[model samples]
Target: MKNITPLQVAILVALATAMLVAGSAHALALAQSRVIMLSLITGISVLAMVYYAINYFIYRKIKLIYKTIRSTKTLGGGEEVYSMNEDPIGQVYDEVQQWSKEQTSKKEEADQLEKYRKEFLGNVSHELKTPIFNIQGYIHTLLDGAMEDPETNLNFLKKAARSADRMEALVKDLLTISELESGSVKMDWENFDLQELLQDVFDSVDHKARQRGIQIQVKAGCRAPFMVRADRKKIRQVLVNLLSNSIHYGNDHGLTQVGVYDMDRHFLIEISDNGLGIEAEHLPRLFERFYRVDKGRSRSEGGTGLGLAIVKHMLEVHGHTIHVRSSAGVGSTFGFTLDKANG
Candidate 1:
């Protein structure tokens, strides 16, 4: 009765009043029969009064509950409803609370997605600006008087070409990463000699290493014919990117070492370099696309900053893990584990 709406209360009151009137009329019609009729009329009025009193009390209680639910302090500032009894009201309250929680979770996820989107755009803009600015500056210089100055024109043209190549490489890597992230890059997996695959990367980058006066060495603890199941082309790209980065950042006469070891449950490969090691803060974000520790140095060395990011994604596709260890001025080591060869 306390939970009844205004309409229900009005109906109850009207019915009670009608019953009282009917009782009174009956008493008048039975006036010839004195005592018993009077007694019945009194009893009927008393019962009606009792019913009305009870209904009024229930109505007040329901009004108090409604007020409580509407107040800001109902649950002690908590988002969820707090009630002691397992009544219908409490069940409805619980459902409302669950809905609120789900909405909150969705809102938080949306905020995080928006933050990431902004960050990605900012990084892309920075990456593009570097090469684009360089190309524009060099082209303008070449047009002004560099063309008449053979040495100067040749230098400017060479630098411009390098910048263009970097831009092209960055675009290609971005596309590759997009395909990987969107689950559109299909992997062709087969059993291949891991050592042989690494050798190919060494051969591909060997000339660049020699030109830079850097030594690229590979040491395989495992036998030469050691085999693992992986996507050969994708894995090759990963190794090439890492090796290229090592060479690019290494000192003029620095050492770049590649080691392969079988660790029973997994095959571990480590590529280490005595180069301009990454700072502690930058190490964690090394695999983030377009993240650069030294913007000038990275551009001068023709790095797009997408190499390690692509390496990470390619490894992820093969269900592998990669980790990096570095000191600011010392050197850096990157190691990854591939699934063990099937027995």
Candidate 2:
């Protein structure tokens, strides 16, 4: 329709048939010139009929598909231009199938995200409700003539204060995660002695570990300092969070150990403890916000339930990752990586 007419296309097809037969005869060395002439004439006649049938029936449908795809999709230069000389029907079919799969995959991911969002909101509300109710009850009791009794008043006030503190911790953790996700908190990167930092964290929590009769130490071979580049404060937070969690769950007279292993370009830090380990099923979602393996026990532990989530975010900001492993009665191990420091 644009440049070449249907008559011209038929003429070209006829000429191509003649040339093809002539070339075949020459290549075969058959020396059958009359045979070549008859073949060309018959081939052209058959080709004309076939071409008319295709153009009138099949070509219209194929061209329609091509046009529909063109109209719907923004075809960049990578897309082949539609032409009668080429069959693009197969390519179109494959592309359409692939597009359908991609859309389906996107929908699945969207549904998953939506589900997570609902769970997060519900978790936040549920977490806040307990402390809020406790505080409300304590204050109401104090106001209802318990204020006259110094013993009851003082005890209720202290309980109310603890509840308020729990709410404060929850809110702070929520802010920290929000800040981390929004990239509002910047990592201050530098080289630091990894072993030295671990000592500081242990000393800070020495009393808590002592109460459990649990000993905290670096693995035997990992006492020496491993220089690494990362945000010092954030890494320390990661250490404290993981180590404290280990101590809280550790068995009496058990051990919690930190290990640093040499990876080619990074150091892997693992915190392992002989504690009440998590179930296998909870491992996958252990890092998720407010996802507790033992919800009742976890709430009693006075944690905002965001420690692991915060640790994950802190390490991730330094382009690193953290992982955990556990067995029912054996122990749990958490591992993470950091870039090696330059000399």
Candidate 3:
């Protein structure tokens, strides 16, 4: 049998006593009837006292526990709040479980943030240290003896200048990322021909491409004017970064191409290259600052390592996304969308 509550026990005890008195009265003499009646009355009185006493003591303890739980919540105002259930102990246990889950979730989030913070700090230090060390070495060499040699002196100074330039670029890129992430960078949105913009980007990097013997091309289907709504200067930067990456990583005499597709309400722009394509694993973090497929190659190519990161953030601010597809040895294509201008 299931265990009975205190109230149930009290009711059962009183009923049993009354039934015993009724049964005994039928077998007792007339004189014993009065005694049986007295016994029943006394039993009932004792049962009533026990029921009220138990409730009084137990309810006091429950009330105290309820107050403690409510105090922990610190709810404002003096208005009454309903209990979670009739059993205050069970309700308290449930609330404690809920609180534990929330705390665990918060701790996990905190741990992730801490990990990212450490990685970011380490990356920034490494990037800045490279140029700083290079500049120091060049200056020391010139100081030791190269200063006396006309041929080496100018070369060393140029090397130092280049390292300084890299440092400046790194700092500027960091500031740009901070501003973009902080929502402080204002965008000047306009309706402009995306085809013309791509042409301009190619033109700007044409000298670099030619130096490497890499051919830059616009797909025949995308040669026509494709009007889009976006921040002109920011989008221009995006194109420059993508195109530059393609050129830097492209194989000798390889081709870098751009294609624009007319999707309803948007234009899908893709930049492709027959270059040193990235591996599947690297594609996921391609837009992470300072992340590189080949660190030595990327650093030697004279970039701040923040180009793709900047591209991703700029597009994100415009409520669009960029994606990439590539095979290790074949080629890579990066695609992003732009809102099509109604005009």
Among all candidates shown, the one with the greatest lDDT: 2
TM-scores for the candidates: 0.71, 0.76, 0.81
How would you encode candidate 2's per-residue C-alpha lDDT over 216-288 as one tens digit per residue? 9888888888999999998998999999899887888899999999999999999999889999998998888
In terms of TM-score, which candidate is strongest? 3
Clashes of each: 1, 0, 0
Worst 10 residues of 1 by lDDT: 79-88
What candidate 3 gets wrong by more than 4 Å, as runs, is: 1-85
Better of 1 and 2 by TM-score: 2
The residue ranges of model 2 lying beyond 4 angstroms of the native Cα positions read 1-80, 85-92, 262-265
Against the true structure, candidate 1 reaches a TM-score of 0.71
lDDT of 1 by residue, 102-141 (tens): 6688889999999988988888888889889999999998
Go through the candidates in order and give each one's C-alpha lDDT.
Answer: 0.78, 0.85, 0.84
User: Which 10 consecutive residues of model 2 have the lowest summed lDDT?
Assistant: 74-83
Q: Model 3: how far is 149 from its true place, Å? A: 1.3
How many residue pairs in model 2 have overlapping backbones? 0
Candidate 1 vs candidate 3: the lDDT winner is 3
